[model samples]
Target: MSSNLTAHHYGITVADLDRAIEFYRDVLGLDVLDRFAVSGPAFADAVGVDGATGGFAHLDAGSARVELVEYEPEGDDADAGAVNRPGATHLGLAVEDVEAFHEGLPSDIETISDPRTTESGATILFVRDPEGNLIELIEA
Candidate 1:
């Protein structure tokens, strides 16, 4: 028997669910689909964390769904790894115009670089979310 897999959603652990939701909705233009809180045994068992509790938000990123979660009694802060680091991952978003998108970004947004064309003919750039999670914007 073979296991079947399909893309459902991408999840990011955030320090603040509310702020993350605002950034995704207002800054990146993703639509807010749903928001809720979870806890107790079922949540703990699913996540493999004891006494787990958190808030979750699902955002619509065009064809993709992005999930943001903030856990209570939060863990220690760790550096959000660079793209070159082992085990580092980033969510790539398709944009209509990379250059224009970069230009309109808030001054406080931390961008890895200005929009640049890839050898494959796509324009792309990296930006960090308010909590330092990396996100890639690509125009093909």
Candidate 2:
């Protein structure tokens, strides 16, 4: 590993690229940076999926970047898995007010629970994207 390694973008595989873009951009308020498609031998080798092909979009998440991807010949439509499950991951977003942010979310959005203060004094909550990806919102 390199000594100067820095955090890069986080990638989420989704079933619908367009829908994901709308939700992350319009709902989460992330700015859309770029969108593209990928395929061929290099892509397949990099992702470890044989014959993998997909469409992807890059979004600006303030301090970090989010890459949303949709594979061709779609996979099974299973839940993204619970937060406690092994191999599951979530995207953390910092907000000014967790409660106010929660209230502004769409009525149909799925939230793990109401914002609650942590032992460290930050209020936080988790919400699921349209594709069931967990997103943590925190107010310090």
Candidate 3:
């Protein structure tokens, strides 16, 4: 029962769908496969929100698909907090050169750390998207 699981996509809730789409589509080079609107109880239960009504984008980043969700924000506007909190998850993207990719990132992007090599010899760095969702770039 444990062998058949295949990851299809990673869902990230964004504050602005258009902005996220532009970043992932233009900046990261992921193609926009679909754009949809989701709402009602099913969406709410899946997202753990009272009423989730917003746009969704399916992005294909070569070998992976990322689902970008723009949920109607509930609470007051605040910065995304610590990544060590429970339920915090981040996406790791494979790149050819971690150092070059880090240098090529936009100036405004909130980069957490510079590219560094791990014990396993994987070069990686962390950065936050426009909505403050963490993303890790690992050298391929």
Candidate 4:
């Protein structure tokens, strides 16, 4: 077996699982890959394991997939430090219409950026979800 870890999945912590679903499923137009409760010897279930009690929502945005998991906080809880948080990072998605995609993004979209050509010779833009998770949208 290959020892290479080519980013099998990009996982994130969300505040509202439902809202996250709407963003990834409806707005971003990604297909729901799967949703299942994590259990057993999973590291997320262990003591001192910093994660969520809620289930995960896996969404396929093109070839790269994302896993959104929200912690089961009692009330009005959100990750204090957001996209800039230590483990938080952006997930890129290739899109047909960069402009339309940026404009049509939900009101809760924390941020958006004008298209900029990447050093890799591709057009790119930055976007963020309500929870401040960054999404780098590339023109397809």
In lDDT terms, which candidate is top?
A: 1
Error of 3 at 95 (Å): 0.4
lDDT of 3 by residue, 71-99 (tens): 78454555466778877788888999989
After best superposition, candidate 2 residue 80: deviation in angstroms?
2.4
Q: What C-alpha lDDT does candidate 2 achieve relative to the native structure? A: 0.91
lDDT of 1: 0.92
Residue 130 lDDT in model 1?
94
Write down the worst ten-residue block by lDDT for model 2.
72-81
Candidates arranged by TM-score, highest first: 1, 2, 3, 4
**What TM-scores do the predictions have?**
0.95, 0.92, 0.83, 0.72
| Candidate 4 lDDT | 0.73
Q: Which is superior by TM-score, 1 or 4?
A: 1
Off by over 4 Å in 1: none
Residue-wise C-alpha lDDT for candidate 2, range 22-135, written one tens digit per residue = 999988899999999999999989987889999999999877789999997677776678999888899998999999999999999899999999999999999999989999
Q: What is the C-alpha lDDT of each candidate?
A: 0.92, 0.91, 0.83, 0.73
What is the C-alpha lDDT profile of model 1 across 21-123, one tens digit per residue? 8899988999999999999999888988889998999999877699999997688887787899887889999999999999999999999999999899999
- What TM-score quantifies how close candidate 4 is to the native fold? 0.72
Please give, for residues 7-98, the per-residue lDDT of candidate 4 as tens digits: 66787788778898988888889899898866444645662355535578988865667988876532454454555677556787888877
